[model samples]
Target: MRVKKLLLTLLLAFAALGSVALAEEHKATPAHETAASEEAAYESKSLWKMMTSFYDTTGLKAIIEPQDGVKNGLGQDMSKFSQSWGRVIMFAIIFFLFYLAIARGFEPLLLLPIAFGGLLANIPIANMTGEHGMLGIIYNMGISNEFFPLLIFMGVGAMTDFGPLLSRPKTALLGGAAQFGIFGSLVGAAMLSQYSGFVDFSLKQCSAISIIGGADGPTSIFIASALAPELLGAIAVAAYSYMALVPVIQPPIMKALTTVEERRIVMKTARKVHKLEKLVFPLLVIMMTALVLPDAAPLIGAFALGNFAKESGVVDRLSNEMQNSLINIVTIFLGLGVGSKLAAEQFLVAETMGIMIIGLLAFAAGTAAGVLMAKLMNKFSDEPINPLIGAAGVSAVPMAARVASKVGSEARPGNILLMHAMGPNVAGVIGSAVAAGVLLSIFK
Candidate 1:
């Protein structure tokens, strides 16, 4: 009788413990459910108001009607129409900004196309670049597997001339120096991820975000697509925005660094680059780069292929296509697809603003680093280069080079070194890609 009573008491104690645990778990579940539903409810209402207003203004009301089957991982199954409105309004704002820049004679060439692409890409309905939509399909075909960036590389190679860099190897260091911004931006992204409340960016997203400072869109896209596709929208937007803002950002630094006479410094025209040098340089570069940093194979290989096709005196048809039709077609889909990623769910947050600010700072720092390096190199070399050329070290191609040239011209009429700047311009390309590879290797 004593043993039986003892056993009964133990069973009663265990039952009480089990009941308490079950009650706690049951209580916790509802709290979570309540919070989630509240968040979903708030987001749905806010998004709905924004979309309806946008449709009312643009006569796209038909596009904003209720629909089904678009699951965004939010609480409610978000309607495609609403998401489309978000894209449309955001894209339109970007376009209007682009036009304002153009009217002000700001960076038009790049801003106009990128802004317009952002708008067209955001159109709802099929949202051609999202899932199964045609543009979305093409976008995936181009970006998912790294085709668009390489194709863009071909065009870049055709348009570039390396004579200045070959003639002046010292300028190469400036290109390398400017890449510190890329690393710095990576650190910034990591910091932001740690602090930002909504989305915690992964290591890959931080790495991809860092490439915005490279000042090369294709490189940004390539790195982002490879490591952090989620960041592609922001990275691309930030890269191009700073590229467009180069005129605004670079001028203050350039003026601060040099005296009027320094800005007016003249450079001799480069001697003719023999056909052999042009053809052999790409091959030698690829071999050396591959040996040193095999991680850079994709970008270097594409760059070399494009350069070779241009200089080989063969495959004229292939080179022409790569330069014009191929790049254009890829760019259209690439732009639209990249632009489409600017959904409100993705952008319109503190983190997005942080990325943009970090990117601009990186660009400014890169430009300063390049110019300072050039100024330092002058102490060691007999041949003097226009310090302004250092500004082109971010690899925006002739755009950056042109900005340098334009700034110099403002200081001194008849100053021209756009072609000479191309050397470091292309060098910056190689340097940025190498930096990107380093980040991927370390972080990815």
Candidate 2:
């Protein structure tokens, strides 16, 4: 009987606790629902405003009329129409680049990201490449500091084998000769500025544009960032676009410059290059170039360090990381950062047209000089060089070299000149950097 009484008392207490719990939940539910509704209303209003921003001046009014409620604003606002049209035009340009990258397979790795970033940058009302934006942060972090291109050069050095140039150091002359194109274009740029009112391109801007002739994208970007940050985008695009078109551009030029008989000439086998020579080459180049042109030290030093780490045999991990993981990472950012500079206001001007013209002239001049220099070298050297290989000195790296080899092979069924062309090919990299240093010094 006592137990039963105790159990009933316990049940009554539990029932009372359950009633209080239910009452509290019931009281809190209305407040929770009200808070959720308020958040939803706020989100819907914000979304409406965002949607209306796109049609701000497009003569589309009914879509946003209900939300705006205010009737004072015009149905068609043309205040910022030019900028809006500029964005539209930029989007079209980026899409065309996308087609080139994806559909046509033109330097897809870099071009694709560049196109995407351009797309992001020109998106009206998003401010995707504005200050503190994702692309802006990326650009300021590496490109503005002029650091990423040097990093890319380091990666390029790590992957490059200097054996071809080392075996036949004379071919380095072809590389040196090709740099005349850069200076030639400088003169052309100056003339354009002096004669044409289209652009008053300063010597600095001319230097940046002329570097495009080197056909070295990283070197081009590095020089442009330092000298003419304003023209970097147009110059980079022209440089890379021309580089991608090398096979088409070079073959015709090579064929035009070299006789059929000269193209058929076979090169002797390259002498065996010792590992010690390979290891010391980068150091020697850095010390020599840096001493002569301190301005080039940053780029040359970084390149030499990368090559040293690669050839030293003790720093395999560092070399691997630089060539593979690190370069890939930087390439993405570099592409995007460069693309950010292609905002419509910057690209639509007559100055960009001038840059494009100057860049083309620079490349053509470089190619012609390289070919002519090779012919001159042939007159002096008993070891007869295939003049076609001289065109590889423009520093498009393996692409220009391959074009030389391909042209040679077409002339002579079994003739192989790829390795021979590579001698001048790698030398062109050093030559271009030196040219950039010279220009930097002159203008400074």
Candidate 3:
């Protein structure tokens, strides 16, 4: 009876401990539910915050919000305008360039790349034009250091034939006269800066802008980079835009300045240039540039090297590469590098309008000057020189030459002025390089 009582007491004690433990678990259930609910709420809030942060960083936010303190070249705060409608205007301009490139076929090679680069540059938060960005790297690599323009000059030289210029040396006079527009526009720009109440352009800026008259894109870039980097974007756009519009711009001026008889005039065929003369010409030009105008030696030297390679006949591979592959690659990068400057902050300024107007006048002036010079030369020359060929003196190369030829043919079909016009076309290239050297000597 005593042993049974002891076992019954132990069972009763164990049952009481089990009942206490069950009551404790029942009491903790509400606390566990509260903690689980708190964790789920915290996770849900975190997910919402993440989505909000992502939206804040997107391009839509960047475009919609006005950047507070963007400044223009003149040190004016342009943020209110630039960050608002300026980007939109730039996009429209880029699209216009695209349309010109794709549909109108206006210098598709450079214009297309330029438009794309401008597109990248205008993206607000992406900072594609920042120092570390792709366009920035490209701009620094070639455009900033003045490397790409020289490469472009080299390519032009490789493709150029000096035969026309050599055959009729007097055509060079037309090229020299064409450059009157450069100086004339220089004076005009200086006057505009001084007299115009709205805009202020420094003498250096004027010098850079005036080079647009030459219609040589690389030369304009080279001079602008050295003389007025601030104005490079506007000046380059004006230069190339006018160049691409050569067919459109030159013909009107040629027709306005020349008489029907002058346009109809035809000339004798050009004498073939000796290979030795071709070989000696580039070297002689390089030597003269070195001795007379060392400031131009860099551009002239690269051009001479390309021509030498071509004329030597031994470096066909090198010449071909320079003409084809090297130039094609450099042209793309050059266009992009140039386009980086077309950002709203740089291009949408008041001075850009001035550049466009002056650039157009300068181009018209150059075309008229060339036509008049040709007409004057015709009065004295034994062989009749067509005034239409003078329009090619602006150095748009074969395009300007072709325009002259086309106009001449329209006046008198069967009259081919292509080869004849190339004389001034080639001379204009040399003349523009020389002009750039002069401007650099003065301003740089």
Candidate 4:
């Protein structure tokens, strides 16, 4: 009886607690309702304004009134000009690059990514080229730090066979001669700066711009980053564009420079280079670079390591990775990083026009110089040397060499100048790097 009575008391106490809790919840309901009502009222009042605000944040609005403080190459405020027209021009350029890469089969591997990155960079609100963005991150990681170009040099070395150059040391002179374009363009840029009203390139800027003549994209980027980073976009684009247009650009110059008989001149096959010589060559080159031009040691060292790996025959896996996978990956990042500089404010300048014009002339000068050098060498040589092979002296690699072979084959039915051209072609790679080192030593 006592237990039952205690239980009933406990139940009555629990019922009282429940009633109090329900009453408190009922009292809080109006506060929650009031808050929700206020939110609804605010939304109703500002719906149109919110829609308008969203519209203002859109790409169209951003392009029409690009965020203020846009500047040109001369450090003048260009916000007025940069409004919609600058972005439109950049878009046109991006699309043109796409056309070249896809439809025209230009250096698609690099050009495609670069074009896409340009598209990203020009998207105003996205700020893809800003410090915190994707392209900026990539640019800082590889390009600004000068990592990508060196890795590319390593990959190039791994892929390149110095056998042809080793077999005929004379071809190194043709490669060296091709670098005349770089120096000649330097003088041209300096002259343009002095004479042209629109262009104002400093000596450092001239140094950076002239590297476009090397026809070596990575070397150009390296030199530009070190010497005149402001001109990097124009220089890189010029370098790669000319490199891609090798077939079109070089053939005209080659044919104009050489006679049909000179093109058809059959050179004897070079003696096969021994494995020991091949192994020793990169070491010697690296040692010479270290002793003479330590500035070039980084590039030459990377190249030598790759070549050593390839020649060792023991590190075939490592060599293959450097040549194929490593290079392919770096090329994608390098392209995007380079394209990050293609923003409207950065690329669309009077200086870009100057860079383009000077770059073309530089390339022409290099080609002409190489062809002329070969002709000069041929005059003194016992064995016949095709003047057409000298055109491959621009560091465009196998493409230039292949063009030489194609032109040679056209002149004479089945003559293969591919191997012969490769000697100077590979040598041009070394020559360009050495030239970059010299520029860096002087400018940096």
Candidate 5:
């Protein structure tokens, strides 16, 4: 009986071993089969699938593919161009920008290229703005590297005359005062983020948006690129649009702030600025700014170099090239490059509307601050300054200055505040650069 029991136990042990081996085989077979299938699928991928999947969802194929299955038909390919609300709205925005450029002549040079680039960007399947595409190349070369803004600044510096600003050093204060808008807009942005919970703008994004208060497009672009690259298109569009509308925007604010008597108040002629002053000014500014705020060195440095070339009177050829040829070329590329960010996916966001609204407020605040500061100065000083010139301190360059002069002349015919307004106008540029530097230092 004991022998019989031993034989039965041996049989049971062998049967258990066979069951375990069968289970192991079952597990290994599925894994091997899955590996082989995966390899086959990867190898069998169609050219269209391979091409569309190259960059993942960023490619046209990935976006247009149906939820159920891969359809490489023409209809599916063209669907993104028409089916998406973002793309459709972007088309409207692009057309509106074109109308503004061609019909109203609002920033025609920049707007035209921007509109054209936007048009190119919206076309489906072309992938004009993909990694290796033309718009992408332009963006990576100029906007991504932050070279275009500096180039624009160089050209602006070469063309700029600091004589007016140098002659009236005190007017630089207005420029400094106008920067209140930037900081004020910061408060507004933070408040919006805190209270609304609708758009969560970080400190960096707020900084980029607030620079719009400077009313300087390149500065806005530079700050946006450094701090909030995603917001570049909306911030830039708002900055440039408000700048072009300076004629329309500033006049109402100017009339509302100053009395006719204040507007008509004419100041004495500015002292003649010597060439030595002009030559030394750019160098002095560069040295002082570099020593104080090295973070802003890129913008301040480029601007000073351009000014140096212009003022030194030694590099007229280089200066002329920077002011004209170099600037013009960069402007075309810069506009188009900036427009690349205006792609539907990027632009049609809640943050864009916030940027536009806040930008307008910042501009208004800057104008008010400059005017108020000038009024305060008038109370303390013997020199009579037309408070109207304070509005020119937003650094829209000649546009702000021209509006100041126009408004002043309108208040009192023959009262030319162009040259006087120019003092604060140019000063505003320096002030804006300084503000940008300050933000860079803090954030960077």
Candidate 6:
């Protein structure tokens, strides 16, 4: 019986070995045949060469077909141009707009780079619009991860100086007032999301869209990327566009809100802020705002660090490096990543146009809020505050302040609203970040 059993086992082992060998030989037939199949496919190609062909490219065929039936015909899609020309046109338009903005000096600082990135993303291979392209990979790696926004904040921080706000802490109030747009715009976006069947904005999308009123690009990008990544392209474009148009958007609002006397409103010249005051103001702000609203602490922290580095007289090397080289690099990546999110399918919607509109309302509301709040503050203070500076409280930084100066000078030539407006301008930065924190916490 034992001998019989052993012979039976030996026979079974031999059978198994033959089956294995046969399987190996069969695999080799197809594995080796793939090169011929790929060569044939390549030779049959048109003017375009085989570039990063995802399927049957490495002399290998998939062992099995996709089980999901390759949703949305992504399998048959094949990264070709004919089917994706719609996307190409959108990208081309963006490129042309960017060119117009750059060469013609319309928001050239940001629009040019964004336009270039938009073009690169729509090259009709691997569909950077949806997934699995170089731009897509970069977008997921950085923007989706919130790395670009945070790093961009660091750069923005380095460029800012809180000296004006430090000189007159009261300007911080105007900054806080300017954030009225956040709440006001939230109502508008919420209304649109409720009423518009075209494209609905989620709670997160509403919050992300609301920050555009903050008039701070990195903050808008960061919040939107985290909360409403789909809206990144439109939100970013609108944010920067409005920022460039600050001089245009704000002055009209200023004129409407205040009289010539208010436009020409002069305040007591600011006293010299002590060196120690400048040194420690950033630290105190970080501590206070971090405790009060930790959601915005990252943005606030980075900005404060930059300000401290600038004022501290120490770390000159780090300061210079952060301001120029570091910021430039981050800006490039941030711009490109933002552009990658602007796929035709995602951006060419009524909601995109709506976002742009709501963004304008937000800017207008924030400006109005700042101006009215400053005018109100003027009622109580013995030392009058320039109502014009109130408009600078919208976090457009030096741009908003510069606009205040320009407008102020138009009323009374040689009037330097720049220094005065700086106070509220820096304050607006903090206020917008706080608004960002509020939105983040509620939606988080």
Question: How many pairs collide in each candidate, listed in order?
Answer: 2, 0, 0, 0, 0, 0
Candidate 4: tens digits of C-alpha lDDT, residues 243-263:
998898889999998889898
lDDT digits (tens) for residues 1-444 of candidate 6:
453455456546745654664565566556545655576655434212332243323211211221222221122332222224445456446755555575556677667777667766544433554557666667777788887777667767777777778778888999999999878998999998888766688778888898999999989988998798878999999999888889889999999999998777766788887889888888998999867998888888888888788788889888888888888887777777788756555566678898999999999999999999999999888888779889999998789999988999899887888998998998888889889988888876
lDDT of 5 by residue, 191-228 (tens): 98889888989999999999999999999999999899
lDDT of each: 0.73, 0.82, 0.85, 0.86, 0.83, 0.77
TM-score of 4: 0.88
Could you give the candidate ranking by lDDT, starting with the highest? 4, 3, 5, 2, 6, 1
lDDT of 2 by residue, 334-397 (tens): 9999988787766777888999899888888888899999999988898979999899999998
lDDT of 3: 0.85
Best by lDDT: 4
- Candidate 2's TM-score reads 0.83
TM-score (all chains, Cα) for each model: 0.77, 0.83, 0.88, 0.88, 0.83, 0.81
What is candidate 6's TM-score against the reference?
Answer: 0.81
TM-score, cand. 3 vs. native: 0.88
Worst 10 residues of 4 by lDDT: 71-80
Q: RMSD in angstroms, candidate 3?
A: 19.1
- In model 5, the worst 10-residue window by lDDT is 66-75
Question: Which residue pairs collide, candidate 5?
Answer: none
Per-residue lDDT of candidate 3, residues 1-444 (tens digit): 443454456546745654664564465456556655677678755664565457557654445556677543234465766765677788778877777777777888888888888888777667677777888889889988889999999999999999889889899998988887788899889888889856799989999999999889889999888888878888988888889999888888899888888889979998988999989989999999989899999899999999999999999999999999999999999999888888898889889999998899888888899999999999988898998888889888888899999999999989999999999999998888999899988864
* Candidate 2 Cα lDDT to native: 0.82
